[model samples]
Target: MTPAFSLAGISKRYPDFSLRDVSLTLPEGQVMGLVGVNGAG
Candidate 1:
């Protein structure tokens, strides 16, 4: 079987925040949430 969605070595950088070396996976019939603070971006 294979993942429905995958993120390998993903990264996002900003002046105030940075996300690095991120990895994620999602199979069938699943839910995901992407959360942040009110002032987060």
Candidate 2:
């Protein structure tokens, strides 16, 4: 089966933090969420 959503080699940078080489996949009929603290971005 194919993925409904996909991410590869994703990266994010901030003055105080960073997200490097992040990857994710979501299949069909699925849900995803990113929960963090108030200051997280």
lDDT of 1 by residue, 1-41 (tens): 58888889999999998999999999877888776687453
lDDT of 1 at 4: 88
User: What global local distance difference test value does model 2 have?
Assistant: 0.91
TM-score of each: 0.71, 0.77
C-alpha lDDT score of every prediction, in listed order: 0.86, 0.91
Query: Distance from true position, residue 9, model 2, in Å?
Result: 0.2
* Per-residue lDDT value at 11 in model 2: 94
Native-to-model Cα distance after best TM-score fit, residue 10 in candidate 2, in Å: 0.7
**Where does candidate 2 stray beyond 4 Å?**
39-41
| TM match of model 1 to true structure | 0.71
lDDT computed for candidate 1 = 0.86
Please report the TM-score between candidate 2 and the true structure: 0.77
